[model samples]
Target: MRRLAALVSLLLLPLLLPTPAQAAATPLQVYGAWHCGDDACIWGNVRSTTDFDAKNHWLIDRGDGRPSVNVVVLSFVHPVKLLHKTTDAQTLDGVPRGMTADIVNYFAGRGIRVMLSIGGITYTTAWNSALAENAAQFGRNAAEVAQRLGVGIEIDYEENSKPDLVGLQAFIDAYRSVLPYDPSGANPAARLTIDLAAGDRWLIDIGRKATADWLRTDTPVLDYANAMVPARQPSSSDAIANWQEHLDGKPTYSPPIPPLAPAKFTGAFYIAEGNKVRAECADFTASLQKSTGSFVQTAAPKGAGLTPGMLGYMFWAAERPSTKGVTTTPPNSCEGGVGGGATAYAIPIPMPALRQS
Candidate 1:
């Protein structure tokens, strides 16, 4: 009789203890920014450390000793050029002259993770040509670049109307063949990821496919996805709405998109809008990063994994995102907004281990 009572207590104890998700919710693991290089999304020339530091002091030192972001994604390697292994005065061994080891070390030395983004909107056609020509080779080339640079890679293929999902898959498969996924995140090249549109509306086909396959918690093919900022900076409420769409996918579509795991993606916000320094770069209090932060940290899972809360925030385009936009230099720095966010969230200097599911 006593033995039976003890067994009953033991079973109840298991239920009494908090589940893994309930024990301690995952903190923001990726507080990142996309750097557009010196030439507005194109690294045109090799820059001396002195000159580079002068323009990017704000990123390295956010008015305090700590950096404003934990990760910096160097925006855009032309897919066609990378595929053809093109080399020119501005490019060396298929990589931009400016995306040299020095620039990577500049951020890495400060305990920040660096990644290289491939195929922006400008390279949409290039992506098609490369994928059609030889997606497997393109993937292999991208892997080579990642291995050489000691950085991660992001696939930003924005083919909205009609996407080449088959070719894209081939590319992903080839890349993974060279460098398999590393949940431990010890291997930088293993940290492969993709970019989705702001919401389920724009990149419908791609979003559906990614959510259904790649972004799954049980069998995650990619590290995560970055929901790129919309055409413009949205209000806090509007931003939440957009992010929520990802959490609860559009089930009514022709081929429904299953819900995405919270741990598998990050929501993006505009640091600056065109030439105007938005609140995300100028004032944390008025920023969407502030207003929608609670949702980002505690939003419940809708139809995917059991865990709550999304990964973290990603700011669009550091430095000059566009030819006419404000340069994130000196007086127009992001110290107040992006920097304040770091402090508020206590973002880990060296990004902590990300949640798998």
Candidate 2:
């Protein structure tokens, strides 16, 4: 029986090989971190002191006609937080202000669609309280915010404490209610996305379940799920190994057709320890190609993982490279105590057709 099983697996290998078209198929989404508006504005955070004007931020490069990078997912739009500071709550119900709208227009003018990440690590605290108490309201609030921003929302709920799948479902249900079904159609307003952590244990539990739910087209929670800062596995081969491991597991829920086709390979900080990052990037790309039969951008090596598949790629704050921490000493007493230069290098691959928005 074991030999027969091996024989069956061998026979299926040819059929499993991705065709050239599949190998070259562009990812569903890709690009840089979109940080605009007051919250994400360089002036708003401790990490940055450099104020990013709309024209000068890291959305794209200035030189040459061709974009050094492609596809930009704009990070942010508060969930349940109303826009405009005032006692009046209704005005606050959507995006904080027209800044999100303005940013979207700027990117859209250049044919780029920004994904509005609803919650970050900090923002999850609010969700922790809101979700269990008011799931439906949470969704409604998200939809309103996305509507006002004129962008899709990426739910970046990285709170390990709040691994409540039920809460996540509620948020998704609420957001989906407000978004248009056809993202590519005319005036197709707002998209729903989620940013998942890629920690080994975390991915096995929270990441896998959340992604499985989103991948299920039938599940009304999310249209997209962005795996954030994917950590490297035990070895280079672990890239594909990790993905297969997730696929093999049983999720609490899922769609008939899984959301991911080529899968995602998003990691941040491409310039750590000099040339080390580049080597890791090479291994990451090779592994995905070998295991999944997909081509990925040659990410510079300081980080873990590769950029493969339709769900393009993303980094953390867009301003990190141009700000205070660009070349600063390590705050904590950890190995490699201090660092210099940009923590990440730019991956200038173009991703024009990845996302509908």
Candidate with the greatest TM-score versus the true structure: 1
* Per-residue accuracy of model 1 over 223-339 as CA lDDT, tens digit each: 999998999888888888888899999999888888888888899998867767888988988888888888888877888977777889999878778888687877888989999
Show model 1 residue runs off by greater than 4 Å. Answer: 1-25
TM-score of 2: 0.60
Alpha-carbon deviation at 242 in model 1, angstroms = 0.5
Model 1 scores a C-alpha lDDT of 0.88
Best by lDDT: 1
Over the stretch 178-201, how does candidate 2's per-residue lDDT look in tens digits? 774554423324555566554334
Candidate 2: where are CA atoms >4 Å away?
A: 1-29, 34-51, 54-58, 68-70, 78-98, 183-188, 203-205, 217-221, 230-260, 263-310, 321-324, 327-357
